[model samples]
Structures are given as C-alpha cells and as structure tokens.
Target: MAENTKIEWCDHTFNPWMGCTKVSPGCAHCYAETRMDKRLHKVRWGKGQPRQRTGVANWKLPLKWDGEAQKATGAFDESFFNQAKLSQKRPRVFCASLADWLDHEVPTQWRVDLLNLIEQTHNLDWLLLSKRPESWSARLHEAMGGGSELARRWLNGEPPANIWVGTTVENQLLADERIPALLRIPANVRFLSCEPLLGPVNLSAIPTGEGHGLNEAFPRITMNPLRRALRDAPHVHWVITGGESGPNARPMHQDWARSLRDQCAAASVPFLFKQWGEWRPADDRDSDRPHWVGIPDGSEEDFSDSPMVRVGKKAAGRLLDAVEHNEFPQP
Candidate 1:
C-alpha cells in the first residue's frame, strides 16, 4: 500500500489483490501488466493468472493513512482558507488498480473480503473502477446477498458512502458501451477514467439520446434494487482524463480531452485532466512554468492536426487548454 501515490487523482492506492487480463484496446499497453512481468515478477497474461492476495496487514494500512490525512490537511486548510476542512477531508483510495472488482472469474470470497475492507475504511473514498461494468453489477449483487448487513445495503443500491464506482472508456465505442452500465450502479460518486484515450469521446451525449448506442444501452432497472427504492439520480459524477504513458503509449488528441472537459463543465461534474502522458500540447513546449519544466519531446505530429507535441505527462501537466479542471464529486 502506498500512502502517497503518483496517480495524481488520488491520495493512496490499495490493491486488495493484483493481476488482470487484457480485455480491450485500452489494455494494449497496461502499466500493471508490464510491472507484473518485469518489476513484480508475477504471472503472464489472460485469466487464472496467479494473484497474490493482500492479507490483513495490507488491508489495515489505510487506518494509519486516515490519521496522516488529518495532519496533512492543516497545510491545505491554511491555503484554501477552509477551517476544519480536515473533518470533511476523506482521503481517496484507488482500489484494485491491478485487478478488476468486476471480474466474475475471480473468487467471490476475494471480493467479499475487499468489500468488508471498504466498510472498515470510512475515512477514505475507495475508487472502485473496472473495465467490465456489467460484470461488476452482477458480481456485487451476489456479494450483497451473502455478506453482512453492510453488504445488504449494497444490494439495496446503497453502497457505502465512501466508495466511488466507475468504469474505463478508452474510446467512443467503449464510452458508449460502458458509461451507461456504470450509471446503473448506485454509489455516492459515479465516475469514468478515460486514460490511454484512443479517440475523441463525446461524453456530452451520455444522457438522454445524443450518445451513440446509449438509447438501449442499459435498462432502467439498474437504478433501483427494489424497483422503486431509490429516487436520487446517479450519473457520471467525476471524469479523469489523460493520454497514454510508457514506451508505446498512444497519442491522445488535444480535442479529445477538450471535448470531455467541456462536457464535465456543462454538467457540473468533476473533470480531472490527469496528464497528457507521452505527449504535451505544442504551446507548452517553451513555457517556463514549473509544471512544464523538463518535459521530453515526441515523434508523432499526425495524431492531431492542431499541434500536439509529445513532451510527456509531466510537462503537459494536468491543464486542459491552459485551465486546470480538478473537480471532484461533492458529498
């Protein structure tokens, strides 16, 4: 468990279990897959690959972090001028970065344990993201029926307040396929991670009828477990966008990130432009801003027509068209 993580979106990353398969184009250059093979010295690709379960000690790490988060909030409170913000400060935890909470192939007991862990860590918001949003809904329902009362709350479509459920959409096809399924899950915060973005995604169409294939994408039944138990509308609350990273990272068009940022703004949803990864916009190439310092150069100019220079994620920073859109779901 890393108390401080390089993933700009969250405070800490806790993998209750690690290891996953390549399910889509987004998995073409998975950072976790490479780490498992080279650094971690773990299993090969595909299902049934060996995953080392994070035991009780690993599960208990966040309690220590909850204490650390309060202390760290002092500096933030002073800067933001928000008094006692620490009390409202819940450290966000990116859960199962190396595994899928929605993978039906994995043992149900493993998910059960992780769900139990999420219940215990009330001070941290767990980002439970998946490539397969459909399976997640099914798997989670199974866990709810057999586990504790807290788990039953999940069955009733009232998952723990601290868990942010989300899905990954690398391109428009996936954005159409996954986002609607994601909205079906009832969580305090519903989100999307459009990293390794391969094409322009029109998130503005997600609601109503504008989005491609969204008309019959998902049944409304996902909204209510008891058919009428819920009245509050859940949607794609937060969006974390970024280009690809690593050796063969793909070039995401500047327009792709821009379109998503616009949609988030219109909807009043949180939009976090995490990074540009291997490519930074051309204008940032000569900037003296500390954030743009020491960024590398790129080769592909045809990826986008309006000048997207590959200066890596660091120099590109988290700015979308010179504006930092770091919004998160409120309550």
Candidate 2:
C-alpha cells in the first residue's frame, strides 16, 4: 500500500505479498511475523504456509510515487543537478519488510510481477533485502526470463540503477555465509543490514580462515596483504548495524557497534547505526530509572557486572557513542 514507515532507513514500505518462514536466528522475534500472524491473523508464517499477495490497489502505489518523483525532478534546472545527485532527491522504498522478495516458496509469477513493477518505477529506489541471498540469482533469472529488458540487464550482471540489493547479517557466521552470496550478484549498490546483531563482526577479515572454499566459490571475496575481507576497494557500499528490539530483545555490546562504525570509516563506506534497540548501556544516566537488569538475578555472570539495561525501545533510542549516525549510500 506504500505506507509511510517508522523504519529510519526507508521512506516507504511495500510488500507485494505477505508471509515468510523463519530462516535464521534473526527471525526468532520477527516483528512482521508477530504482527501479521499472531495479532492480525492475516497469514501463517512457516515453511509450508501459503503466501498471500496484496490487493491490486497496493501493487499500483509505487506508480503514483514514481509519478510524484518525476514531477519533482522534471523541471529542475541544471543547477540543481550540479548541486545534488538525482538519487538523493528520490524517495527510497523498502520493497518487502513483511516478506522476502527472493523467497523460494513464493509464487514465481508474484516475484516476476514485483520485478516488473520495480522496473516501471523509474524514479523510486527499491531496497530489496533478503535473508536467502543464495537464491537471488536463480529466482531473479526465473522472474526476468519472462520478457523483461531489466531482466536482460540483470542476467548480464548489470542490475538497474534503482535497485539496491542487501542481505540480513546478524553475526559473523551469517556475515560470512550470506554476504558472499550477495557479492556474487552485480548490483548498483550492495549493502549489509546487521540488525539484531547478536555478536561482533569483522567486515574486513574472515575469522574462519577456511572461507568455506571461498578461494574457488567466491573469487570476489579475497584476502589481501592486510587480511582485508572482500576486495581492496570495499565492494559493500553501505552498512547498517543495530540491536534487537521488542519483547525478549537481546542486548548488543557497545564495542560491537563501535567496531563496525570504525571499519566503515576506514573503508570509506557509508555506515548507518539504526538503533540501540530495547537495551542501553548500564552506565547511562537513564539507568537510574526503574528498569529490568539485562542479566538475571542469580546467573553465572553477575547482574551488577552487566553492561546493559532494558530501558524499553522508546527511552533507549538510537545513539551510538553519543552520536546519531544517519548516513545513507548515494545511489
């Protein structure tokens, strides 16, 4: 429906369909599943569940947005283009927050239609994030094989300018697993969403050393003299890292977020810290307020030694090292 979203990274959220199965640890407390399945009962969420496509009216919303964008930029003088890039002026649409666009179980025709819709929306930037990046090429090939010029460009490894592909990477393990898959696909802007970040991640180096046959499987992800993962030029254009929110939200270590910010800075890539989630540092002034301690009363680790506090999502807010990082990659 092209609804305005509270998500900090995107201007709007559009789902061609509803419903998705849990694929990783990040899906343990998925807000979409909770809202769509548990409360609204719109669709069941699981491996065998049926995916429900949204109404035709919802599908046409992007066309209206693209029309608005065209009107905004159509008459702009050359001076405006010289000052700011066209992508910075356009609104970004998070393609599918409620479902994965690359889900294997979703009807092929639905994905094909969505791709067509994306192709038609010339002025709108579509952010397509998926958990199953490994299936992107196959699913995209199937969708594009249906007489789409955009498909030809994509098959040729030249993705459309408006399409920004990313994958959800919650930890180092997932970072290694999914990122290589995403890097294989050629895209205008490639990114990583480390939301609900469970553990520390080194973007520049692969800790496993094994790389799961990375030398042969993914030649693009190579280790240089500095032991930098990926290429020397930083193939990942942007990085968005944040903690978990909602009930049972896990606490993210302060150093975890800091390390990512530092890595992005060194690589000269755009880094965006979305939120601190429901947990904040225990040493903050807000800790004086009544809140649940991050650790249990009697656990192997002492609660007093815990470095985080459950101050609720609103009060916790989105600040890393006392700085609000709201950076975006230029499309």
Candidate 3:
C-alpha cells in the first residue's frame, strides 16, 4: 500500500497480490522479488507458488483515493474543455507493481474483483502495465464478463476511459514482439516501460513502428507482400525509459535512453526518464556527482567506449544529459 509513492511517474501504487514468476530478462533483479520473497517472505516467487492477496483494508485503499478524486472533480468548472482538464488532473494508480494483473496463474476471481474495483474508481486513472500484453485481451474480456458491452469494448481495443494499458519493452526484440500487440488494443493512453533497458532499441524500427514510420510508401500493385501488408498503425502515446536499480543491476547504455527520447520527441509522444538507476556516466560533472562507490579495478571495462560508474540510485538521480524529463500524456 504505497499511497504516496516515490515512483516519479505515478501518484500511488497498488498491488492486489504479491508473488510473480519471472517472465523476462527485465525481472532478473526485481526489487519486488527481493523485498517480498527473500526479505519479507510474504510469498515465494516462481511458478506453482500461490500468490498471496493483500488484506481487506489494503483492497479498500483505492476506493478512498477514488472518493478523493471525485471530490476534486466536483470542484472543477463544468465546461467541456474543463472536463478534459479534470481527467488530466486525476491521480494515477500504478496497479499491481508486485504482480501481473493478467498473470495466467492468478485466480480468475482475483482479476474479476480487481476489475470491479477499477469500475468503481472512475475518478482515478488506473495504469495497468503488464509484461504479458499478449494475454491482456483474453484476461480483460473474461474479467468484464464475456458477452457484455463493456467486454465487447475492451475486446475491440477501446477499454474504459480511466484505464490505461501498457507493456514493458527492454530492447528491440521485445519492442517488436510487445509493442505491436499493445498497439492492436488501443487504450486511453498506451505506454511503454523501457526501464532496465538491456540494449539499444530502435523504437521506430520499420515493422514495429512504435510511433513513427507512418509515411513509408506502400506498393501500388501489391507485388511487395510486406509493404502491402503494412497498414496505418496506432502510435505509442508515452514512453518511460530508465536504467536498472538494485543488487546486480545492469548498466544501461546512455545512447539507448537518448535514442528513445529523440524518437519520442520526433513523434510528439510524451517521454519520461525515470532515473539513471545504480550507474551513471563516469564523465558527469562534479556538481552532480555523488560519493563514488569503490568498484574493483578493471570492473568498469566494458564493450562500450564510455564507461559507467556505480553511484547508487540516489546519487545517480533522474537527470538525462542534465535535463529532467517529466512529461506525461494528456488524458
């Protein structure tokens, strides 16, 4: 129950349950797994392990937040433009930071209960970020009640006004695999969490078309199957990129973050640089530098020309080339 979160991007964080099997490379050093399983022993992390749901009072936290949001909404001016402004003013809830809401192993009833809670919290924007975007449609449809109109809208890629869906893309392969699946189901604001970025990712890679490649020419006679197959694709509304944190965290290439930020700027998509994580460029100015953690000699040697120094998360900070990117997509 992180009612007041320090996640940089969200107002609060709510995890319905605790426990998750590692699905991708990004989960290698999960802070949640470290804190919950190894330290707190709240729930074991792996397949076949049962997810432990939070207490009844924990479940009611969002209801309280929603009521507060409703009160704020009531104070806004009633003009049509102000309605949009009010939506933007709504507090964001980053749901299931400790577990995947669409995790196949979680009980179906748990997901249904979460959905019911979301329905009641229309005043708050629920960001349902998942590593498993492929399962989102089926899971959401079932949770919404299969034959209902709400279910139909979700299946049709138009989810509720307050729900924003997103997926994690650590590199090009995942960006290719997950971004397309995410774009297929348009949400109020679709986003990509490129946190713990493993390698350089070209967000505008032709076939993936994260938020670019719209002007590419199509074959007039349909001889080129690939070109003809391409259709106008939906754009990613926001991009959140950052390096890794925690023990054994991998250092992200500075260019990897820069590439994403440049791509987002070109596409007019909002971009948020969360943090530099546990590593920072060795050449950073003395004014911004923190107490340097001593690393073994030659440990800094890497394939890249520019080396990174382990500075701890607090010292590493969230500045990207000295600029703080705190942009968020319009609701």
Best by lDDT: 2
RMSD of 1: 7.3
Quote the positional error of residue 284 for candidate 2 in Å.
5.0
In Å, residue 85's CA in model 3 sits off its true spot by 7.3
Q: After superposition, how far is residue 19 of candidate 2 from its true place, in Å?
A: 0.6
TM for candidate 1 is 0.79
Query: RMSD for each model, in Å, please?
Result: 7.3, 4.3, 6.1
What local lDDT does model 2 show for residue 76? 43
Residues 1-331 of candidate 3: C-alpha lDDT, one tens digit per residue: 4467889888999999989999888888888899999999889999999999888999999999988977876743345323563255789899988988889888877887887787777678889899999887777667666334555667776667778888998877777778777766766567889988877777645354333445546422211111222344455778899988888877877778988888777667788999999888777364454434343221332435656777889998999989999998874
Instruction: Point out where model 1 deviates above 4 Å.
Output: 67-88, 145-148, 207-232, 283-304
Judged by whole-model lDDT over C-alpha atoms, candidate 3 comes out at 0.76
Worst 10 residues of 2 by lDDT: 296-305
Sorting all predicted structures by TM-score, with the top scorer first, yields 2, 3, 1
Ranking by lDDT: 2, 3, 1
**Residue 189 local lDDT, model 1:** 68
Candidate 2: residue 237 lDDT (0-100): 82
Q: What TM-score goes with each of the models?
A: 0.79, 0.86, 0.84
> Mind giving the per-residue lDDT tens digits that candidate 1 earns over 1-331?
3446878888789887777777888888888878876677775656877666766887778777765764665433333422232223667888877777777667777888878877765556788889998776578667876575566787676667667888888887787778777766667667789887777787545532224356666643322211111344556667889888888766777877888887666666668888888766666344552322232122222443555555666765777767877776664
Better of 1 and 3 by lDDT: 3
lDDT of each: 0.69, 0.78, 0.76
